[model samples]
Target: MDFSGAIFEGGAYFLKAKFEGGAYFLEAKFEGWAYFLEAKFEGDVNFSGAIFEGDVNFSGAIFETRGMFAHVEKIEEEVKFSGAILNRVFFEDTDLTKIRFYGTAIENAYLAGANFGNKRFIEEREAIDEERNLLQHITKALKKPGLKSILKSMFVFFAFPDNSYRKIKTKCKPISEAFRRAEDVYRNVKLSLQNEGDYETAGEFYYKEMLMRRKRTLYEIKNLKYWLFSHIYSKLCGYGEKPLRVILAAFFVILFFGTFYWLTGTVTGEGITDSSFDYYYFSVVTFTTLGFGDIHPVSFTGKLATMLEALTGAFMMALFVLVFGRKMLR
Candidate 1:
């Protein structure tokens, strides 16, 4: 059943169809809804370089052998496979950013290098800059009011420089909708990866999911406190998935308090000393609540700084242990 480079302008239904041999849909374009509900594929199936612009479904379908869908460029909506029997399906090097998986169970699935539209802060900033530049170009071209200028603006709008970093298509829909869908997909994929015993990948997806959620809350929901908490959680320990971040946070806290103690000046048996190392040593003692009593703060501000440093240090130590233990236990 060859459908190489075929174009489906409308609905493509193959309900309960049985393909006894290999099925090929290489470079096919699905411009509308595609359905293969309860279909049976007895041999290998390929859909490399396909473009799905609408809804797609393979619910209850059975793939007796391997199936592949690599290098899919654009998928505008969900490509559901709930209740499908995917024996060995491969989606490597595919962009699944807009797709959603619901109630699906995957076995021997290969999803290496798949894009899920999970952008970090740096990537998001780059995207924003790109958008700003594009808008500026478009505005300048439109001000001329000529066919050539209009064409150039259109070209610039559509002919975005293709790169690995461009995962989400910002023009497809609203940013909030994209974020919501991304959050949902990340959660589902995280759960799927956890079920497959890939904790490290699952943790990465979990971080992405939280990032999307945080953005949604901040921009869409306009929840200031919630966003602040989420931001702090990400910075402190990456939602408990990165123990190294906790260690760094603790080190920074100690350094900050040490500098504060040095600037404010403390007391020793030999009176006040301007040495930075002595203040740092006293800072460490205060942070750990050692309380040797050989060194004390003379001014009220210095005493307050020591008290706050002790409290902060204790909290940071506990947080580090909690984060590290969570990672180790998992």
Candidate 2:
């Protein structure tokens, strides 16, 4: 069934609807609530370039074959997909921050350029209260028995439906089910991007997934070890996704050991000198394992520090290579 360019001014209710063949909704506009609860699609379903201006729901819907829901400019309200079965769906080049995927089943979904929740949760949640309040007021007024009250309600809605009914603000509260659901969605998206061979984007999603887990473990689960491990991983190398972090880490390690050697004093051909550059040079040489023998550590603490610097340098060099290579290849 083709619904291309159709306008759902009031709403698009397809509750429990069944489509035996391909279902198309290309470039359709939904100006109000859109309900597809428990709907079934036997073949490919397309909704490319659709516009949703209000609440959207696809709870418990099933797509038996490939589906497309791409190229949407924006969605004014949070989209509910709780318990939906999305099989081989494409959501490329779409903003996905407002999409709630709680309990949703997904397989082989393409989400390239689809944004998951970031710091915009608070910003988005705050922006929608005006429209929501206006709508609630209108709904409550229209429920009265008198026709005059209904007209007055409609007038009030037209006049005070502020914020242009365009966008809504949304933020996921901490230690809530929404937070956990978002974490799950991030994990699924990360795996899906990985399967698509988009490793760089996959790495970003992986970072978000790990971040969500870290926050949950720290705040809700209260697991100190897990939180510490995750925090260290992020601080050290951004979970293997950031080459710059690795580079910075190496720089700091070199500087730290160089300062240590300078303070402890190293022996040279002319005997120990207080020159900072000399100790720094010795530190670099020892770190790279390029022992020049022109300068050596006489103190036991200095010698032990050299060995430790060598091990750290090797590890940092290896890490930099790995992360840099991944970034370049991706």
> What overall lDDT goes with each candidate model?
0.68, 0.67
Per-residue lDDT for 209-267 in model 2, tens only?
Answer: 67767765664555799889899889988988887887787778888888887765644
Most lDDT-accurate candidate: 1
User: Which parts of model 1 have CA positions greater than 4 angstroms off?
Assistant: 1-173, 270-274
Give me the candidate number with maximum TM-score.
1
- The C-alpha local distance difference test score for the whole of candidate 2 amounts to 0.67
- RMSD, each candidate, Å? 14.6, 14.1
TM-score attained by model 2? 0.54
> How does residue 199 of candidate 2 score in lDDT?
65
Worst 10 residues of 2 by lDDT: 152-161
Q: What's the TM-score of every candidate structure?
A: 0.56, 0.54
